[model samples]
Target: MEEGLENFVPLIKRSRGYEELEKDVIDSGICSGCGACAAFCDRVGLTEDGSVPASECNMTLGAVKCNIDGICYDCCPHVSYSWGGLEDEVFGARREDELLGQYLKAFAVRSKDKEVLKNAQDGGAATSLLLAAVNEGFSDAAVVTGRDDSWSVDSTASKDKKEITGGAGTKYARAPGILKLGENLRKIPRLAIVGTGCQIAGTRRLEKKFLSSVPKAELTLIGLFCYENFPYTRLKEIIEDRLGLKMEDVTKTDITKGKLHVWTKDGKKHEKAVKEFADLAPESCVICRDFTATFSDITCGSIGSDEGWTTVIVRSQRGMDLLNAAKEKGYIEISDKVDLEAVKKTGGFKGKKRAKVLSEREKEGKFVPDYS
Candidate 1:
């Protein structure tokens, strides 16, 4: 019996989960379901669905470390500021009308991956810019949106901030992952944040709230051209019940090649041709007045081109310098094209239409609608 007790003690000491949880800090936002151990030398692990098994994570007395540090628990953006915490260092700015004059600052960029272009909700420009910012130390971390594992259908990720690294291209889902900025601002001194029109507007508001204390050097905003985002519940219904695909089987989904393409493991490859899905664009998006992400230092999307590239509009001198430096460093290939004015015109037209519609509505006594 003593021999058996000694053997069990050694077994507990050999736990991988225990070691990682006790030693290594977990970054919930960057977890890709690559199941390694948590800490503690225990066997606690991540599932393919990106969730952790709570049963395996149960802690008991006699354990050297408490189980408060479970990776599964640590990995939740909803819980820990571990993924990306917002600190008091954030400075906010408000510049909605200013966004229009800054419209000319945007431009487009492209890559050959039809997959990358298509998977991106807009042009691949936002992802490229984020990569460039991190590479140049313009920011130590980037905040972008992705699908919430909990809410599979919502367009918003977490309505909180997330720290993303090694840009795997843009996550074109309908969720807001940048909402956590308030919690994470302390850990990250320099941050590059990406958001849609309304979110950026909200970010500007937040910036203003923190402006007195938060330094401008701590934050950079990149706004994506948002047309509309589908609600997650309805989207799930459409994809699963209507299209006959399981949610878990889906590896990726995005608007690409002028269509909404969905890839699933059920041996199904389907698409909503741009014609059909384009009209389904959210009404909130149509009514939104900001088309060029004017509030952002740089605005990126595919409003200008049908082919493979992101249209990046640089509104501030800082934005221009960043792009030029990226070119100098060879992180991006810069080419001056003649059609830039034309692209700006396209964005302007859309912005005008949106503003006109909103004005008409406001005159009739309506508040800015919140669709998400």
Candidate 2:
């Protein structure tokens, strides 16, 4: 090997950049496109198009700018992530429960507002939380997901009740939920990021690293319980081909009780075995180890609660304060009774499954990673 070229390949492999992320994770078909790299880094850009997916980090247009301090590398949760370390760092206490994580309160929660209830999935708890965060001034703008004219989902910084409500329903497709978070950093004093485990993991790293510049103390992170997210086109094929229903005709989608329940415009509900959509799940989701978004101040999902109610896990002091205020202000209601054990049972199963996959990958000598 030539003197100058001898260390080039190894150096590139070792250094962390968008290009590195592209080759190792994205091109390897493991990039979830959670938008953490795009949301926080100035040098990286993410696109949701199929042909030029977020997995494609275009180095021809933008080169590496992270070699100086490795700040961008630090922002990625996948490069190397330790859930237990982060939980202790963020919460200042070790998690006693393995699956459901640390929480001050657990509840089967529902929205008091009829509008949110009508539009949201699972009793509107996540949407209701975003609305309350905005109304209570805990957040000036929120990072949320909404659909376009073509019904494609994307992340946006929502500033008002209308925008928050517009992003209410679950699209059930994987989209970059925090792709544009940095754009609104200066515009909004306090910003709340709502996303799945992958996105929240990346956001948690970014929040911790960029506190001074981004007003770290003012930020709020809320997470969703995600077992698996599906590919859009494959999901459509399953819904339209097997179920014989047009994608547009389906009004809302929810996964509960081992079925994919799709509601339509005619006020009719269609159910399909979730196993039918198994092949449509992304390659990235297969090895992910987190089902509960344990890093966030608050995490909400439907797994642990009764039907039409969201399982709420208030994980931080800030989350507790916000939930209390929201309840007092007539935004959310706590369930009279909750199955606390149910959250643990479901979440533990998901965690165990993920751990097995991660262990298998390690045995196979493949790259085992989390997400950013």
Candidate 3:
């Protein structure tokens, strides 16, 4: 237990459980299946149809079900969050602009390493940072989202740069990097974790408790910018069946300037207007209000940078420190143009859309949507 946790009583097994989760989260279409529930419980898992639900084995006597007394509930990102509190913990203050979160610097950067740039989604900043952290012993490993054999997203932990780089690039589809993490996280005591908004939120929500559960583990979270995400199989179907492109022929995927582009190893490209695939985006993601992953140590994405460069948002001082150290070590190079307007334009747009959706939901009287 952590220092203050010694005074906290440990949970007994009786609590509101999967039944409540199904009603509030699963049915509500906000369950991202990040698997924090299952990471600690045997009875909960992601179902075949891509939903996270508690298994029948959770039932004990006729009506009683197994539970950890709302442990899973507290870990849920959709149920609760306070970015202000998280920023306070990390940086001792939050940014004045609610949309920008807290940050030390924003820049256009790319890896100086040719190998990383060749494989990364944009500038390779995220990959380069992780590579430096792991190889230089700043981290034991890193949890990352990468492609599985079926082209679906796979969440994994990697110690070596080879394994890390293999998972690079933009996987625009939904992969609960948090959920797919499974048991591998147990082996990583000190490390970095990268994921989308929801995943980062989950990590921050459960950071201390989750770390307490693990023996010596501590985490530095990296959040990827996300407007929305689609189901993996459905996205693959759109590419193969609808667009007449084979999945095997695809090597890269990117969403840029209102277009979806998939490129092959040979540099061939298949393109689709961004709106054409919008309806396939997850219902859970549709109401999401986060654009820059305001709660993470750092947020990186392709939105504000030129081709082959990434715009990095450093939230915590630690994030800036790691980035600077990596740059000094020749991991990456920085661009002179720091484009705040470009970032603000896109981030603000998403924030507005989020507010409109939540405002409508609040008026409908179901409940006020609070994804803080």
Q: What lDDT does candidate 1 reach at residue 168?
A: 34
Clashes of 1: 66
Model 1: per-residue Cα lDDT over 130-205, one tens digit each: 6667778687777655444433422221122122322333444454343345344544546777776655644544
TM-score of 1: 0.57
lDDT digits (tens) for residues 1-372 of candidate 3: 333322222243444456666766777676766666666566777753457766664643333344444556666767755666666766799778666677888888899888888889989999988887787667788877788655777777888778888878877676656664435555565778888877787776666544455445567788888877667777777788777887777887787777888887588888898678667767667677677787788898888778888888888877887788888898989875667777778767665555776677667644334545
Whichever of 1 and 2 has more TM-score, that candidate is 2
**Alpha-carbon shift of residue 56 in model 1 (angstroms):** 36
Sorted by lDDT (best first), the order is 3, 2, 1
Model 2 quality (TM-score): 0.85
lDDT per residue as tens, model 2, 47-106 = 553211334333421444343233445566566766777777689876787666777787
Q: How high is each candidate's TM-score?
A: 0.57, 0.85, 0.87
Runs in model 3 lying further than 4 Å from the true structure: 1-16, 56-67, 180-182, 212-215, 351-356, 363-368
**Per-prediction RMSD in angstroms?**
14.5, 7.2, 3.9
